[model samples]
Target chain A: MRRLILLLPLVLFLGVAVFLYRGLFMDPSELPSALIDKPFPAFSLPAVEGDRTLTQRDIIGQPALVNVWATWCVACRVEHPVLNKLAEAGVRIYGVNYKDDNASARKWLAEFHDPYQLNIEDARGSLGLDLGVYGAPETFLIDKDGIIRHKFVGVIDERVWREKLAPLYQALVDEVTP
Target chain B: MKRFAAALLLGLAALGVAHAAIDTFEFASEADRQRYRTLVEELRCPKCQNQNIADSDAPIAMDLRAQVYAKLEEGQSDAQIIDYLVSRYGDFVLYKPPVTARTLLLWYGPGALLLGGFVLLGVIVLRRRRARGEVDVGLSQDEQDRLASLLNPTPSDKKD
Candidate 1:
């Protein structure tokens, strides 16, 4: 009886530990993709730069990055510098301007310094929902053959650039050279 | 003034009709009604913030309740509607997730830990018993005899 009483506390501790582990980490939403290894969703919109329209067909013949952002999304601002660096390295970037007015998008681009080769306005958020986007500031990497190779939700960081985008970019260059 | 009076009467009649509509949906059977209540209490209203359809005033919750009732009217079981909702919304919509291979550890972890503790307690208890059993106290035959006499209290021993 005395020993049982002593071990009760240890049993309770282990039981609680196992419970916390299951609760905290196990319930993230199932990552679903209709676009994985498939061609990018088709879209054409007025460019953030020139009067010409930018379409999905223009990006398909080469490896590219599609960044979804709005002027109101704070995380998009945080990720802008990393994108600018990617642009400086001559990475092809296309912007999917999400649910914002043309005036605001133009101002945000001017303020943050536009890194996109072509910007496509998705004003109604219909395109975003079709792409399974829950929130703003997501980046998708497409391979040279127009296949969506990767999806990064939320802000892009230097570590993500090094770990994720760099390897895929390198592989695309290798494929082209070989 | 006459137009205002007519509008007031019409508003009162509309209010009465709305009240009658609420009363018409009042459940008939005590047992069936209790089951319906239980289902709502357990099932989550997907569009509400941690609330069930029974408690939520959200339009989506009302629509969901209509769907549930339609299925019930078709003679579908409570479990069937719950299964349909789960299939559409994923397991996150379930207030109490089922105990499956994925949730095995979550459901039984507490019991397993308690059992493990009892095992440790048993081992400690057995070890203590053996340790206590090993100690021997030396007593001479005379001392034993006197001690036995004191405990037994024979007639002569009782006289003292």
Candidate 2:
């Protein structure tokens, strides 16, 4: 019993150490959003340059990728080509221009080739807050019923889009299309 | 004259600090303003480095502050507002985390460790006391003398 008591701390410390070691390999940025499986938060914002507005209506009733981005976000610029490819592949992608200068955002899209079907100008980032966007270049996968399925923080490159997002998007499409 | 220069510099520095402060919003009532204050201080800014929304200058924090005010105006309770944020941002947004199965260890581990330390200390102290009581249970001087005499039984004493 005395030996067991003395070994208790070593056992507990080893357990904690194992967990910490495992955590070191995990991505700190991949924080799971609470919005997953929950209805997409309601937001209303003006179109980038159009007189029309984008609201919850644009989000619900379809499987779509809402990419929260800004002209100042380098990762968004990095992911621009992949997003363009996704657009060509018939993926419905909407851009939420979060907390950016409108003119700069427009210029970025023009220079990089616009990939978004419609850009929602969240100049004040009110919509981004509703969507729980921590920073630019966060992508949200919304299901057909307007429920947010997944959120990917950081750049959505070919690898991330293929491995992480595409399979989930495919599942949503299969369920909704049929 | 030097004192005047110092005062002017101090005033200028104070002005700069004031100018650097974030915009303060007004609420409908004192209660609303108080709630807003409490909410922002309790909510964590996800992008900032260990900063609450009230202290962080991050754009996300600004948006969260606006949302808090808007929700207050919409007649939401403080809990509802916080819950709304938690629903969107996960428990990471909360300063006071809820008691959930996942966080039970984080909340109770300290208490368990303290208790264990106390138990161990008590065991060591108790064992030390027992050891002290058992040792130098040496013979008294009278007892020692009596023992010595009995062991070396003099010739006169050996006759009996």
The prediction achieving the highest DockQ against the true structure is 2
Kindly list the per-residue Cα lDDT of model 1 for residues B96-155, writing each as its tens digit.
Answer: 878899989879988997998899899989999998889876688999998998888888
TM-score of chain B, per candidate? 0.62, 0.73
Error of 1 at B2 (Å): 42
- What does candidate 2's lDDT look like per residue over B1-160, in tens digits? 9999999999999988844637577777898787888888889888884888888888778878888888899999998999889977899988889999999988998999899899989999999999999888788999999999988988877764
| Alpha-carbon local distance difference test for all models | 0.74, 0.86
Error of 2 at B70 (Å): 4.0
Candidate 1 CAPRI classification by DockQ: incorrect
Give the TM-score of chain A, superposed on the true chain A, for all candidates in the order listed. 0.80, 0.90
Q: Highest lDDT among the candidates is held by which one? A: 2
lDDT per residue for candidate 1 within A1-178, as digits (tens), equals 9789789789979987998988798534333344567677777677665788767787777788889988888999999999999999989888888877889999988888999987888786646644645466888888887778777776888998898778987787677668
**Winning model by TM-score:** 2
